[model samples]
Target: MDPGCHKLYHVHGFDSRQFLEHYLSDKADMVFGEESLKFPIENLTKVFTEGHIKGDVLIDLSLSSMVHHLYSACEFFNHIIVLKAQDRCILELKRWLNTRTGAFDWGHATKLHADIEGKCDQLQDKEEKVRSAVQHVMRCNLEQENMTDPIVLPPADCIISTWILGAISKDQDEYIRYLRKFSGLLKPGGHLIIIEDLDGTYYTVGNERHHYLTCDEDFLRKALVGEGFVINYCKVQKRTNMSDLVDYSSSIFIAAHREKSV
Candidate 1:
């Protein structure tokens, strides 16, 4: 692993397909299957079902081409906008949305969502829902003050970010700074749902190691509060499986509402 590759979010270096295969494949273990996939899917389903996180526009800032996190969200938010820092990721997502050949299959994830939602027979329907709801897949630059510059986005009713922050931020302060940028995208009192790898320093993709921030519950709570978010629900699951591909102790899911600007 090159020391320089572990410093910042290198847009072109990530292998989206390999990432899916290693961490979210059909044979994924407890860490990726349960912590990464099931935790967010189940919690987001519950939050949306509770009728409090109402939203029309939702922006997703997940890493790579992963769409498993959006299965439940598509049911709640009418329009979904996926923002990615890498063009490769955007292209990958577009391939799936356009039903192009060589696109990654999300059937397993869709089935999981159907099973959790108690509508097991609607597996194909759930997949279609996600495809239909996603209106745009735009490239983003997290280094820029306005990540989606030159194409200003409407204030989103909700923002769901997963794993991107940890990969983008090199330190805790940088994490809080990037998080503030996330807060700026939400409407006042709008919801912000974040799912992150907790206390992780690095994860590998096709032999390339990527940086991950090592943040704990206290730092995360303080960071959210400092950014004017009132956390409504938070859950953390300890890593149940060990792997050299990734080094993370736990995963965290937090549902918060941005404070109304006074």
Candidate 2:
């Protein structure tokens, strides 16, 4: 489900915060943070230095709003182009970016990221960093071969996609096709970071249910390699808690670099 597209806040006592507190990080103490958040941030910090940070990075920032993938990213990329699948998603992101009246509460996310970096108290600073780093917010169609279509954005130094692919693709073949289109937006040798659900078919947001494409590591590995990526890092976080609403066995984080053309 596109979080920005959902009517989450209106639902009274929405326990999404509590659910995330459990799912995204370890249930006990939450010391390490969630694998989905921790993996990509740590990897980005390690690979791309401040010198390479001035280039373009394209991302689906709507998902990152709650997940806070941009927490580490903003530390590097000077130009961030956020690709929104719908105008609603664009509006949702803008609300937070503009610091509007009722933007999605990211306090939990902001603090978590700071703690991960050992800067435990500067929540507002972290939020401002992300807000300032994102320079462009534009529309994209995941089903189309040309994701950005007429925009023709500068080829990105990196690209990050969250759970949107599973919602858009009906099956494995479509997943690969979508992946190829996303990867093509990156310059050769540019990095691609994906956070995917493993064996996940459905999840619930508020009271509504959403469908997802179930995929395994083998499928992901083949897709990346066939699409010309050499895997740099990969890992799976087995589901520790179960809820009737979401049916996912694990979360997998993959970081791969596109092979340079001769």
**Residue pair clashes in candidate 1:** none
Candidates in order, TM-scores: namely 0.94, 0.80
Where does candidate 2 clash, by residue pair?
24-34
lDDT of 1: 0.84
RMSD of 2: 5.7
lDDT of each residue in 67-174, candidate 2, tens digit only? 377778887777788886655556766888999997666676677667667788778888998888888888776656776777777888888777767756667887
Which numbered prediction scores highest in lDDT against the true structure? Answer: 1
TM-score of 2: 0.80
Stretches of candidate 2 off by over 4 Å are 1-54, 61-67, 260-262
lDDT of 2 at 199: 87
